[model samples]
Target: MPFIDEPAGTTPMTDTAAHGAASPWWQDRTPQEIAALAAADGVALLPLAAIEQHGEHLPLSTDLDIALGLVDAALPRVRAGVPVCVLPPLAVGLSLEHSAFAGTLSLRPETALAVMVELGERVAAAGFRRLVLFNSHGGNKALVDLAALKLRVECRMLVVRANYFRFAPPPDALPADELRHGLHGGALETAMMLHLAPAKVRSGRVGNFDSLGRHLAAAGRLLGPEGEAGFAWMAQDLNPCGATGDARLATPALGDRLVQHFARQLARLVEEAHAFDLARLDGGALDRAD
Candidate 1:
């Protein structure tokens, strides 16, 4: 059943498991807790990450690890009584580009979308009317946007798909040489892993991979792993190493700074987006043709 409309104020905070109770924040909770939270402060943060290859040095779960890390970091900044539950990170995503690499678990775009839509409906039904999809993997960006659109129409829930990097800058801001865009396992990502999970980052393994460094230097963009120097999809373009950019410069200090800055930016975005008005979305203005 749809939740009853709450009075303008008098919302309550949900009780955490720490209070001698066992209801998990995301999976299960009492109806009174949900209603009280909806009245006081209603916002849900869904951490989205990929379980794909990040080269030999990083673990397959690096993206999800960092995403969960952000959730931990942001909890304090949320409203004191708000029921800010960190939904389990979606650990698998569209990784067709990195399929050549071992241990890369790729999900069809549609599957990813379906999972998010289902989760959105459940949360909205439980009175978490404001939903934010906090994404850690780049590949999940488009699909998250699609899921947000679908959820808005079907569930009337406000879903915002946020990318951490979209709000934050790299530590020392990495000179232009490093900013040259590539696909997987690049400088920014490497630095992030180093900061969030230092034990997992493989900085020494940067060598013997990606000859396309020279091409990126010369062409200003990665021309794929083979230096093909042409436009192509992830599967056709990237190589088997699961790396696209230089990882040599990645350091734990750099990673720490990146994560801190990223967290600050994301916390601010969540606060601003928390009060966002979804009914104002101009869907009628959109044209099918680009």
Candidate 2:
């Protein structure tokens, strides 16, 4: 799938008519229209984001903006056979690590999980068989994973959880060392904001923080180098400003490339979801090992 790069400021909400009647945004269509689409095996995309702080350079709505931007970018390229529609985004997520920061809003893990599961159930009840939980915040991973499982079991529907950044191609311009630790409000994120919402990025205040030691230590404790130890830590513990990489290296061009790459990858996933057969696993018998 190819991504069509629109000029800066051409947002999804503003340009719905360009997609014609096959638009993927559910909010743009009436309930009766959605019902007709659902009868044809349509899938729903629910963008999950966080209203959290992103250092001094990025806006508090950074995650929400990126989540919507990525979904909007991918929707036009979705396979014609799969009628994927995007639901209004769930913009508040699990962001306890950023709770100390001003303007940061967070939901407890259980609260987030319950909200997602309820949304999934409601979508399923409305006759949609598939629900994609498209997440953009790292803090929401645990909740999304758990909610996906519970939704599938309780709602008896296909539920998928996708983290947007996981589909992003690595920055070839940066060193491998920098790539290993730049996970938050860093060059990658800043560049993305520069391309998608430059007005919200404080380019003059862009800076860098080498947090490799803190990240590795946290990873070793939580995930374990050899899978042996575990612990908990907050963003404040790693960096006072809550940023993790060299934002100074970010550029609008790089942001554009990253967004296009992520959109292509996401489109492919949406295509695959359309063809998956849930009935194949419905009546299979378990074989006992001899």
Candidate 3:
């Protein structure tokens, strides 16, 4: 489905509707208003992020800010027919790998799972049948996958676990090796920060780090030649700065492209999720072995 841009002079539904405005923000609506919105088949977007170190050049809230920025950019682009409610972000996630670094706050994997499950349950109870777990941090991927599965069974809701970076436009200016292995505090992330929050980025402090080599070494050990299996590793093990990739190559122009690309894809996902048919699936059709 194509993204629908609002026509000029048209105000958001939030400004004119009594069932809470069409602002697409959960925090902006009252409890009663939310109840009404839930009854209207609104989809709830919950941003999952981490408060961790992003090297000396970037602020600790890099993931959190990027998640929120993506949401802010996408909500407006959602088709007018889909009513979306953006929930306040869960900033602290599973970041134990980065705990060795200062300014890194993390929750254990189990704790993070519990928090996400409870949040999903609460939102499901609030009359929302669609919940999107929008994650920005790499460490939170496993937690989100688990939560999405359990929430589907327990809450009986359509849960979507989306990683923002997965929607980013491929970097043409950077090398394929760097783009593939630079998972954190890298050129992609730094550029995103430059576009979303330039004040928090220390451009002068940015430098190159060789995380790709470490990542490959770890992958070779944990993952077989086919890259099927995985092993555990810490952020420090990858690089001294607790970051990967080359940050010195980050530019505001690249950041803008990334942000816009991610936002557009995210908006499309939200629209599709809102229109998904949860009742059509045949749960009993497949055998466990199949």
Candidate 4:
């Protein structure tokens, strides 16, 4: 069944089990608690997402919700007593491609990079040695990678940059063509939104963006990780609705499956970050190759 239409943000976002209900959020923790956690090899998860259009259906926070929700869901799956804290979401990111659409917001690339570094520096200053930059928006991908490298050098922290969707393989149910064409505002995103925040997903507003398919096919270009050659395109270049892909096939059932799968994979990723040590890269690491 389709979700009932509701205004954006009608549903509350997920909170954390990594810290537990007593102090589920990083901002809620006292300075002593934070420092103690940092000393325990704590890994800080920072979610970066864009406030942008997702056709006429999904909320602007779609990316943010997924990033945050996945973090929230994954936390408990981590073995008990692992020190990981999720910061409040950054909320806005690089959305230049969707800037033409109503309700879209973006930051300049340099500003975005600076903000990420500044946040990482503060985390390090607080004695944390690890940072996980969890991003959900496509536009933020390259910048997130750059931010991780910058944090590695500038903040002296073990930084891991990643996208939520990349953690798990796409569900086998998704068609092969969609694997390439469903770039944004597609079945995958819509389904996730349907599962994560059903109230925010408008019923019967699904749009088809086969035009983007035609455009991509004509250019002999590819999108996403499985590509050889990529093209520079704004969200509107391929679709007027500010959407691209076959969202008509999306369903809450599929969304539920994705949420579980993605959350499990993300939990594993967080565990890896928690165990990783910055000191491992020291001791003349650059001079040695194994």
Candidate 5:
């Protein structure tokens, strides 16, 4: 599906439309409305995701789903002092790694790079001084990094890509075995889905990890099976299931904690990054003693 543009009425508010508010941030705000908000605060949140296979139990657009949920969870926190708004998620991304999977949809990395660059320029023009690429899909990392670098140089605005998992490290919550095999549709993701979209999860669907290392070795030639090898050149191959972790151990309780933990951590990161002084520097000895 195509990305949704910010509508007119929505702007930052503690209460969500789901919570009986008329509009949330980015729903439908006039240019003046956005400008006023932007003048007050300089940051915006852009959610990034992929519409690719995520095993039989999860939705094809699981990445987008999770990203949107994270945005919802963060709305109140960011809106207090920031003119934070969520851009419609980019559903297609560089998914060539999972092409072997029947339901996996892939996009050229170049396409994402171009799209993100244009979006960043547009947002900058609209007056946001800082943009956060809140990413939920793994495949879009390189593309996001490239886009952030370009925006930083050209727009002179701080652009950052915050991966949900990496930003919010998993606690020692789940079983060691479950956590050990945890990467894709494993316990963590499944639990999040359970908490966020209980109806979407196929309760009957359950599976354990096959030997992970060997599977990764074979897939490494393509996508490198998660963290099997350092990034090189061509796209690494991946399994057809578009899943890597074991899902059998996933439960709703686990999912809730993980999601809440991640949301809180992400909120903290945004707070810190927003306050960071990107232009600060140590003495390079280029100046003579005054």
Candidate 6:
């Protein structure tokens, strides 16, 4: 659901009970074990997120923590039949948009691209055929997408570049207005953080920071910082608090629902990734689908 389009009719499967303790972390596995997983056509999940400002109410590691949490949640659900391993997440990403605020760090665009290319090379060298470039920070979307293409071309690895939220269906409780602001420090993100790491979430500081489009739409110029009309932006351009969206609408209960939703969707993706291949998708498949 998060990438281009989620394949329909994916069976929901999770067998960690039988396959538990198999060590899906690349760091936790020995070279021999890794080789075995690779031989089994394992997916190498590479999570990329940013350490940046998520308003004053949220911690700087909000994006990183949530992305990692999603990986943790999805791993258990991956069926025993599918081999999957995680590369430790890249903590810093392209976050110049949020650099106006303190505690926001970013990798230069070229550095980000180079690092991804190098990591993809290493993953291919490790004998893995599939790589998932899972990105959480919206700021990293462009570069990460480019990196996925690069990995496919250079490393010859089957790659999936996706935003974690793309897996989740829109929440029913969050109003459309609130959802519009969810791109940055809005309700969905705040809700998920509250569910994942509540202690780090500061209360009494939430509010509805208006979307930048609300100010610019009157100009009939669709040059906001998200979706088809999006471009580079400073977070302050949306709100001085350095986070857009309505955090006041976030709740831990909503966060729990969002987390479970994303995890379930991700499990299906890992399964699909295990079976997806470039070779099998030749004229026979493409001609019919296209």
- Against the reference, the lDDT scores of all candidates come to 0.69, 0.79, 0.84, 0.80, 0.70, 0.81
Cα lDDT tens digits, model 4, 52-99, are 998898889899888877877888898888888888889999999998
Indicate which candidate wins on lDDT: 3
RMSD of each: 6.2, 8.6, 7.0, 10.1, 7.2, 8.4
Per-residue CA lDDT of model 2 for 58-88, tens digit only, reads: 9999999988888888987887678788888
Model 1 residue 207 CA deviation (Å) reads 3.6
Candidates sorted on lDDT, descending: 3, 6, 4, 2, 5, 1
Q: Candidate 6: where are CA atoms >4 Å away? A: 1-20, 218-221, 281-290
10 residues in a row with least lDDT, candidate 6 = 281-290
Candidate 6: tens digits of C-alpha lDDT, residues 87-194: 989999999888888899999999988998899899899898898888888888888889988887777778887788665465576886566555787888899999
* lDDT of candidate 3 over 1-290, digit per residue (tens): 11135566675454445464456678877677688778878899999999999889999999999999989889889988788888889999999889999999999889999999999999998999999999999899999999999999887899998998766565575777667667789999999999999999988889887773545656655552113554577887778788888888889998888888899999999988888776644464344432
* Clashes (N, CA, C under 3 Å) per candidate: 3, 0, 3, 0, 13, 1
**Candidate 5 ranges beyond 4 A from true positions:** 1-24, 175-180, 214-228, 231-240, 281-290
In terms of lDDT, model 3 sits at: 0.84
At residue 123, give the lDDT of candidate 4.
92
Can you list the residue pairs that collide in candidate 3? Answer: 13-22, 14-21, 14-22
lDDT of 2: 0.79
* lDDT tens readout by residue for model 1, 1-290: 13356555655332432456433256565566566666655688888888888777778998888888777677666654444656667788877766777788988878878888898888887777788899988778788899899888887777887987566475456755456444457777787777777777665676423535545557766454333464445632444565666677666777777777778776776776666654456464344432
Error of 3 at 101 (Å): 0.5
TM-score of 2: 0.85
- What's the lDDT of the predicted structure labeled candidate 4? 0.80
Give candidate 1 regions above 4 Å deviation. 1-25, 28-31, 79-83, 208-217, 220-232, 278-290
Model 4, residue 173: what's the lDDT?
A: 60
